[model samples]
Target: MVWAWLRIAVAVVGFSGVVAGFIVNVDRARREGQDLGLVLANYFSLFTIVSTIILIVTFVIAGLWSLRNPGRSPEPRGIALAIAGITGPILLLGIVYNALLRGLPSEIALTDPSGIHSLDVWATESLHVIIPLYLLVDLFFASRRRALSWWSLAVIVAYPLLWLTYTLIRGGLTPDPSGAHDWWYPYPFLDPHGGGGWPSVLIYVAVMLVVLVAIGAGIVAVGRLRSRRAAARTSPVGAAG
Candidate 1:
C-alpha cells in the first residue's frame, strides 16, 4: 500500500512538472512572437518530454495495479519490462541534461528578464533531477519488480534508436521558427551542422547508444539480484538457512 502510494505520488509530481514546463515554454514562445505551432512541435519532440511521458504512464499503471492487488509479489512481467525499458532513457535524460545541456540556450528563451525564470528553474529541476532520482530509487527498492531477461536490453535500446532517427530527420526538415538558421535541432550535440558536423553527431550518437545499453544492462542485473533475494525470502531452503 505504501509503495502504491509512492508510485502515485511520483506520477502526480511528474505530470505537474511536465505540464508546468510546457506552459512556461508556450508563454515564452508567445512572448518572443515565435510560431506557436512550431513551438508545440519542438516541445513535444524533446526526448525529455517523451521519456517523462513514458515514465508517467508506466508508474500510473503500476501504482493502480498495486492498489488493486495489494500484497501481490512479482508484478506482471509486462510491467516489470516496462519499468526496465524506461530506466535507461530516463536516467540518461537526467544525466545528459545536467552534464551537458544545463543553462544552454533553449528554444523557448526566457520571457521577461524578471518573471518566469524561477518557475522555469523549478520545472527543469523537477523533470530532470528530482523525478529521475525517484525513479532510480523505485528501480532499486520498489516492490513487485521481477527479473527481466538479458534480451530486454534490446527492447530498452529500441525506443531511443527510433527517437534518434526521428529527431535527425525532423531536424533536417523543420524550419527554424526564429529564422536564425535553416534547420533547428533540439540539442546542440545532435546538430550535424554544428562544429562537429555529421561525424561528430554520429560519434555522440554512438557513445550515447553505448552508455544507454550499459545502463539497461545494469537495470536488468539489478532486477535479477532483487528477484533472487525475493525468491530466497520465500524459499524453504533460504528459510532453513
Candidate 2:
C-alpha cells in the first residue's frame, strides 16, 4: 500500500518535471526566435529526457499493478527485469550530468532572469537528480523483486547502445539549430568533431558503457540477494538457519 502510493507519487513528479522543462524550453526558444520544430526535435533527442520518461512509465505501470493487486507483489519477472535494466542508465544519467555537465552552459537558456526560469531549474533537477536518486532508493529498498538471469545484462545494455547509435547517426546528419557547431550532440563528450575528435568520443562512449554494465551487474547481484532473503523469510527454516 505504502509502496504503491510512493510509486504513484514518483510518476507524478517525473511527469510534471519533464512537461514543465519542455514547456519552458520551447517558450525560451521561441522568445529567442529559434525554430520550434528544431527545438522540439533536439529536446526529445536527449538521453536524459528519454531515460527519465522510461523511468516514469515503469513506475506508473508498477504503481497501477500494485494498486490493483493490493497485497500481492506487483513486480513479476518481466517487470522486475525492466526495473533492473533501467536502473543502470537512469543512475548513469545522474552520474554523468552531475560529474560532467552540471556547471556547463545549457542549450535551453536555463539562466534567463525571468519568472519561469525557476521552474526550469526545478525541472532540470527533477530529471537529472531527484528522480534518479529516487529510483536508486526504490531499487535498494523496495519490498519485492525477482532474481534476474545473468543474460539479462545484455537486455539492460541494449537500450543505451541503441540510443548511442541513434544519437551519433542523427548528429552527423543534422545541423546545429543554435549555430554553435556544425553538428549538435546532446552532450559534448559524445561530439565526434570536438577537440579530441572521434577518438575522444569513442573513449568516452567506451568508458560510459563499462560503467553502465558495471551498474547493471550490481543491480542483478542485489536482486538475487534480495530474492534469496525474501524466500528464506517465508520458508519453514527461516533466518535462524
Candidate 3:
C-alpha cells in the first residue's frame, strides 16, 4: 500500500516539475521575442518534455494495472522499457554536461546574459537533475526487469544521433538575430565557430556515444540481475510443490 502511494507521489511531482519548467522557460523566451516553436526547439526542453510525458504514461498504466489486479505483478511491455532506456542515458548526459563540464553555478547559471531567473534555474535543474534521478530510482524499485532487452541499446542510440543531425542541420540553415553568417547551436561543444572547432565537436560526440552505450548496457545488466533474483526467490516454492 505504501509502495503504491509512493509511486503516485512520484508521478505527481514529476508532472508538476515538467509543467512548471515549461511554463517558466516559454514565458521567458516569449518576453525576449522568441516564438513558441523556437523555445520548444531546444534539445533540453525537448528531452525533458518527452521524458516527463513518458514517465507520466508509465506511472498511470502501472497504477491502473495494479488497481485492476491486486497482488499480481505488473508486466510492462518492451516499448516502455525502450523509452526508459533512452531517456535515462540522455538525461544523465544533460546533468553531467551541465553540472560538471559546464561548471553549473558559474557557467550554466551566472554566465548566461539572457538573465537566468530563480524559477528558470529551478526548472532547469528539475528537468536535468531531478527528472534523471527520479527515473533511476523508478527503474531500480518499480520497473519490471523482465520487459527490458539488451538490443534496446541500439534503439536508444538512435535518439541522440537524430538529435545531433537535426541540431547540425538547423544550425547550418538558420541565421542568428544579427544576420551574421554564424548560426545558433544549442550547446557550445557542438558549435564549430567556438574555439574548440570541429575536432572538439567530434570528440564530444564520441564521448557521448561511448557514455550512452555504457549506460544502456548497465541498465540492461541491472534489469537482468533483478529478474534473476526474482526468479530465484520464486523457485523455492515451485521446488517445494
Candidate 4:
C-alpha cells in the first residue's frame, strides 16, 4: 500500500538521523578546536540520560493502560506492548550496564576521545535491534481494521526506521579510526567504507527489513486466528446456555 511504503521509508530516515546527529555532535566535542567536549558532554549526558528515563516511564504507562482494556482495543494493545516491551527493556539495560559494567559512580557518565564510549554502543544497539521488531508487530495488528490498509502499515514502520538512519550516518561517515575501533557487535553495519563495503551494510538492512515484515505478517495471522477461535467458542456455548 502507498501508506505502508511511506511509513517504512519514514522509519528508515528517522533512525539514520538520530544516530548520525549524536555521532557528529560527539565528534565535534572531541575536535581540538571545538573542545566543547566539557560543555557538550554535560549536555549530552543531560539529554540522553534524562530522555531515556522519560521514555521508560512513558512506555510503562502505555503498557499498563493497554493491558487494562482488551478485546475491542486489541490492535492498540499490541502496538503499545510492542514499543513498551522492547524499548523499555532496552532503556533499562542501558542504564544498568552503563552504571554497572562501565563502573561509573552514581550520577555520573564517562565520555572521552574514544569516540563516544562503550556504554553508548550497548545502548544504541539495544534500542536499534528491538525497535524494528516492535514496528513489525504494530504493522500486523494495525492492518486488520477494515478502514486501514497495507499502506497504513508501511507508514507506521517507516517512522522509526528513518530516524535511526539519520543518527547512524551522522556518527561515522568520515571513517574515524578510533570510532571503528570502538564499534560494537551487530552494528558494524555502520562502519566506514561499510567495513566489507556498502554491500555488507545493505545486506544487513535487507535482512532486517525482511525479518520485520515477516514478524508483522505472523502477528497479523495469529491475531486473526485467535479471533476466529474466540468467536467459535462463544457462539455454540451461547446457544447451549
Best by lDDT: 1
lDDT of each: 0.86, 0.83, 0.63, 0.43
Model 4 clash count equals 39
Q: What lDDT score is found at residue 152 in candidate 1? A: 98
Candidate 2 deviant stretches above 4 angstroms: 72-74, 107-111
How would you order the candidates by TM-score, starting with the best? Answer: 1, 2, 3, 4
Whole-model alpha-carbon lDDT for candidate 4: 0.43
Backbone atom clashes (below 3 Å) for every candidate: 0, 0, 0, 39
RMSD (CA, angstroms), candidate 3: 3.9
Q: For model 1, where is the 10-residue window of minimal lDDT? A: 106-115
Tens digit of lDDT per residue, candidate 4, span 168-187? Answer: 55444322323433322223
lDDT of each residue in 1-241, candidate 3, tens digit only:
4445555666676677666666666765566565566556653435456656666676666655555656646455654565455555546566555755555353324434555466666656665676567667766776443546778777667766776787777877665532345577766677888888888889988987888887777777777788777777779775566
lDDT of 1: 0.86
Tell me, by TM-score, which candidate is best.
1
Per-model RMSD to reference: 1.5, 1.7, 3.9, 11.2
TM-score of each candidate structure, all chains considered together: 0.95, 0.94, 0.77, 0.43
Error of 4 at 222 (Å): 1.9
